[model samples]
Target chain A: MVTIKDVAKAANVSVTVVSKTLNGYSDVNEDTRRKVLKVAEELKYTPNMLAKNLKQKVTKSIALIFSNFERANGKDGVLFQIMSGIYAAAVDFKYEVVIYTRSLSEQQNISYWKFCKDHKIAGAVVTGLKTTDPYFQEIVNSDFPCVVLDTDLASEHTGSVSTDNVGAAKVAVEFLISKNHRKIGMINGHEFAVVSRQRLEGYKAALSEQDIDFDPTIVVNSDYSEESAYELADSYLQEHRDVTAIFFASDLMAIGFMNRCREIGVRIPEDISILGFDDIVLSSYTTPKLSTVRQNFHKLAYQACEQVIHILEKEEKGRHIMMPFKIVDRETIKEL
Target chain B: MVTIKDVAKAANVSVTVVSKTLNGYSDVNEDTRRKVLKVAEELKYTPNMLAKNLKQKVTKSIALIFSNFERANGKDGVLFQIMSGIYAAAVDFKYEVVIYTRSLSEQQNISYWKFCKDHKIAGAVVTGLKTTDPYFQEIVNSDFPCVVLDTDLASEHTGSVSTDNVGAAKVAVEFLISKNHRKIGMINGHEFAVVSRQRLEGYKAALSEQDIDFDPTIVVNSDYSEESAYELADSYLQEHRDVTAIFFASDLMAIGFMNRCREIGVRIPEDISILGFDDIVLSSYTTPKLSTVRQNFHKLAYQACEQVIHILEKEEKGRHIMMPFKIVDRETIKEL
Candidate 1:
């Protein structure tokens, strides 16, 4: 097969000049272009049809944009699972997946849309960006095809995939209520996260359903970190001595809270029942185990990638897709 | 900037014709080639210099080749940490990282060297290959730069980074000896893994150092999976009632063994003390907090990436680099 280099050699000009002349750039002089063309014809060099077609259409490439893939020995269960899912899905779709990890600070200066354009990406799957992030504004205004994980933005080209946090949280609290635990406290992640707000709503909805008055003092906000959860749980357990159970927004937090309980000699289920969300792997390994709401992160990721690919392939607007959640009953919950 | 499309239009030929004419194809008629060349020259189209340069040299790209990224919510701690480290280092070096995941069977057909050549990768960091793998034999013969994790092969272009498994295992067994825990047993990963063989050597060395005769009957081989370890440990514990302490080759296996002990009415440390290797994140969170040898996977990864990049940029041959390991004292070990 003939190559671009052969064409350049035959034309007596650089490959770049030949490429520019063929690619519709506006800089080549007509005389040089004519000479190069004449030599290429005499040499019988044929342009690669595949390369030409590739240039004519949008490339089948997607970006998995993450913010801080966590430090080592860090809690990255959900993130890892999601990445695995996206990669697996991309393999099936035959779309190339490129990962771009940017810290929150770096995200301020990097436009996600511009990044996609520069990479010639057809779409992107974004994760770990807060709603208040400047990138969120860029995402909302741009027409780039994007599917965000665990976050929502109203845009024609942007889709979102997250578990039904409100419903899951309600189920978690309701399960505790069924066990006759009315004095249940809530430990939530950062207020900036949309899931946090939705979980809080679910908690309140469960309380109202059970005719139990909502207690604002029992709800503690944390930064979705294990250490923060431990600290917050320690303080909450110290002050709210009467509270019989607590619902944590994440399994990592629940583990931290359980560790705190061990330190304080507070027995799970006997002294207080606990429920968590996103039943991470550690939840099952913990002694007495943990009862929590499970999010289908793999399915969420698959759907997110599927959605973005759909929009790109079909030229259709994107929509939010919610994954189902279920309550996993283990040793963490007990009846009064 | 003059473009090929413009030249093609002016010369009344397709872009491919113009491209082929300038690129030196011998298939085009001499008359048409002359016309296309003249048109391209008149347009003053300069080929892209960056693209041309890219074709002349090896791309600054590296491959993170892995055997299976397991589907379990298991201890992917080392794998995840190493990936994080490699990505971090790649960012500093401005190298692009591509990941290739293929099973041993798939690897039998895919030549690692060819993969790098096809992808234009300068080097690769390989993980999870057994010593007997056919790919390892290929790697031994190929001059492609590679830094393998937890394995050793004698090749100038191939380097390896892993914790001193033999020394670490020796230290672990010696710690048990210091605690007066004689009659120790071992639960090791598959023999195909170089680490497993090293650990076994270290175990025997420790026993020899203590003037104790090595008992081959007490050592059991597992597939390095948590479930496999659980079954193997259960059977081993049931049969070897005389063994007082057991050292697991991996933390996941240790956790599984501990869980098996729970089911079989054996109390950890009090009944049969256990020590584990690879202080995974969950090791610290386990009920009794596992006492294990900590592999600095992050550092190993950083060093591996650095070494491969050095070989690529400086044209230096690679060498094996061993990372240090330390024992983390926790509740799992009891002084006999």
Candidate 2:
């Protein structure tokens, strides 16, 4: 309830001074701004966001509209950790993060534009970008600056930061093949996500280099979860009994695959080597610490935040930034 | 950027009519509102929030301001599950959620009024209400409608929703005493959080009823994390060789204690029994499957949302709401 007027009264300055000082308008004197800020703090005065955001044309905030639809349940991998990085960077830049996602209700389909405009956000860090999602496309086309993560959207309008998915996948295959596993299977993510498509190409590319057959029969599409991986692997393994190793698109799916393997009396690494993508934290703790691709999610998320801020500042625009990825060696892989 | 004008043009209505319709004003007829909604959907027109929210005085959004400091690297309980529930509920209400927390630098020292005012939030859900926290007192004094979680700030001015921490703890200890644990160890939370004190008191109350000695030495204060739990349990076990069982204030802390136990080669249930509070998903997955006092976090979060909505509606100003807790019998417990 502490409005701009109260801030001005507390600071012993005009309302215009308080408003200008609070809005990052460089025209205000630093001494006056500091005095206003100090008094505002003591008085517990909250600047009127509605008035300032409208006039200044910046909230110094970012919107992260998570699709909670993707089941990211566990504390694993760099996925959520990467998110922490964005949070860290935002805080470092003195920006607020507004997270608008699905709550408990079935009717809670979010209105992206309204949420953004209502907040008067300077930019956004887009996550859980579903392929062909109309909402994603809308934000991409908007004048508002946005940084898309894990997806390469239309570069002309949006800044994107992604891990080198294809390179990571290729490294995983090279490691597996180096260990003398020729008949490898892959539990893939649904082709809707750009990362999944990139990973698949990497898998195929690795196979092609080694003169291995690109067997479609060995590939099964999973819906980015442990259970999905379990189901996909269950059927894939059943169909391709000769395969000695399997690569999963996600850590959860890999965990699921491991769970199913245990249920069906299949020994990991000894009976079949399993590799997971996303090297989440759980991968290291799993019974057979998974060998997998590691996307520097923290780096990716940080760069994403950095890029969005740059775009908001108009120092750069529509940047397609790609960070590096690696394959981490854990206990899951078998020796040749 | 499909604006209000586009929606109005498509719906064959004036901009005022579209605004009125979108804002749920009585001036607009139901037929016109329906037409605007339908055409807006067809064109994917999300209303401009800046124009609408300032005038209507409701964001239909809640800001969840968490304590940025003292969070674990991962495996956070109640808060994590509560978020899951909040997500489910927000979906139902069609309200956007904004996540706000102090930056690491500004965490211990924050200006709550400035944070809230700058955000332009109508209402907020304040989680992790630390007693010493400046924000706690600031929020308690604020006239704005807020829902504080996991605290007993039962007053006419604010709405509070939490599990009966004392009751749940008493039940846990009673269950253990029933199993004949005479010298039980405990790892409690930080002193600032009310649940830590409540649960600790409940532990003593249950012991008092059973005519057991309440040795202060048996209790160790942790920040409610695996590392702290590990340290507490490691030292406590070293000192109290007669301790037959250990009770944890949180599942993550219990998991930490278990890890410590593992390092020391003390077998769970056999060497030292463990009882965890908050039946997180980890409880079911951890080695020996943690026996726990289960606070229905999902329901708790859902109820918090519903309570805030109720308070906002002016239907009732119910201040204190307690969700039920249950004892989950799992592998970590044993008869002493």
Candidate 3:
């Protein structure tokens, strides 16, 4: 097998220069870097990353920690989108990704820091963690470089990435209000999730801005499950028949609501217009094509990976990144 | 940080015994293993995987290579299911998963073997490779331990895992035939894909067995793309009006055909019935829920990972594993 030494000698460069160039360090001049790469390719030199990482005492890899990932299995593609985005960004940065599913970690009784240490992971991008989770506090307090998704928790080492959930929800609700719907009911996800609470704040803000009285009775919470949302919709719709529109915390919840409406002989847009958050794939194929606040999950995850990489490689202090969101109008909403 | 030596000393065992016990080797006696694990846990010993992997000359990690994975991004969650299965299996075996998206490899001009060598990947589970792909032949002939998905290519070091595509396709076509449909057209995926050829053979065998004259003109091919299938459906439907039903090679293609049928004012199962393969998530949500053959994608990937690990750890000869499939009857098919 060809070694880096052979490539360095063939390229008339020092071993350090060859290593730096191959590892994408910017100090190496462009011409020298190209020459070293050409020599390495010609000699078929495959660097042993395990050995390099051992010598450095840190692997050029990031851990993607998704808490309770299996819960989303086939129900929602949001986690998959985030994973793809992380992979794409990791590829761009020439870093490997090691997934640490939090459920597995909990089952093994391994903490996030321990998993990172055992794997020699340089940084991590964590998602699907509720603020009340034990791991959430541990991650916030740990000095390990990481980017937390969906919650604004930044420190010297920890970064954050999420769509402006509050603003996005406010915009979604204002869109329904703009359609002359005065009585709008909101179905939210669990309050334990920071995003859910933020979205609720946005919902209330939108009503306040429009001079519409916010009714606490009309706002209900579900555990982000379709069945839970379906059950809530069944009861909420009966008691809140005067409401002209409803805003769902997630597309999956909206789908459940739609299913319940179908079963209960309620017509969408004719009976009540519905708007949802998270423009998941199923939203487009629904009966009336759900109008939603589209959170760019891919972009959010991509930026999280980028942020963690930056914190690791550049020794930069972590910062919060708010990605853009859009209001997607489909057939579900009506110009009441 | 507590090291293996500290744990071994505390447990009154040799370092090698402690290492073997902690690594889950059965050679260590149960009492020693239990004592070593307890000591290690009590001491908060986190093994440095980088150094361990380097010393062993191979990482306890499997590479999951997905060729052109981005093509399926959000359209179908089959790849995600496969990934989830792989991860679940990897965690069960205490092995780490490193994803290698082939698109990045192609752009960087890295061969599969080179990647394995660089990362010291113990084994790999490869999917979505065409028979004619340059990497496919390389993987088939390579000495590295691996398991290929959806293709039968077994050597001393290479295993194969896939659903029984031919048998499943035969059953699907037979179901349509049993419904008293005499004239059936077929829409296949790209000819280069092995599954497409297998399914086509099954379609022909079903026809031959039932004494239905095989008309080659009625069979058409698309590039396993929704738009391509949609365009093909337009002309195919116009040309073959006598066909009472059509068999699609994949659910995605079936969806495309369904979309075109809706546009041309052709009612499914009334004007023409449809049978699809690969029960993707969208199939259940289509206008008149798709009836199709369901390949257990998650199980396929899980078995593939298990096979690769078995080949690497136990020095087992690679074998072809055929998983079962099911015919999911929904609303797409109608009795003649």
Candidate with the greatest lDDT versus the true structure: 3
DockQ of each: 0.14, 0.37, 0.69
Report the TM-score of the second chain of model 1 against its true counterpart. 0.83
Query: B81, model 3: CA deviation in Å?
Result: 0.4
Per-model TM-score versus the true fold? 0.84, 0.84, 0.93
Extract clashing residue pairs from model 3.
none
Model 3 interface RMSD, one decimal: 1.5
DockQ, model 1, C-alpha based:
0.14
* Per-model CA lDDT versus the true structure: 0.81, 0.77, 0.87
Clashes of each: 53, 18, 0
Docking class of 3: medium
Scoring model 3 with DockQ, what do you get?
0.69
Q: What is the interface RMSD of each candidate, in Å?
A: 5.4, 3.2, 1.5
Which candidate leads the pack in DockQ?
Answer: 3
Using alpha carbons, what is the TM-score of model 1? 0.84
Candidate scoring better on lDDT of 1 and 2: 1
Task: Give residue B192's lDDT in candidate 2 (0 to 100).
Answer: 62
Model 2's DockQ?
0.37
The candidate 1 chain B region of ten consecutive residues with least summed lDDT is: B48-57
Backbone clashes (count) for model 1: 53
Ranking by DockQ: 3, 2, 1
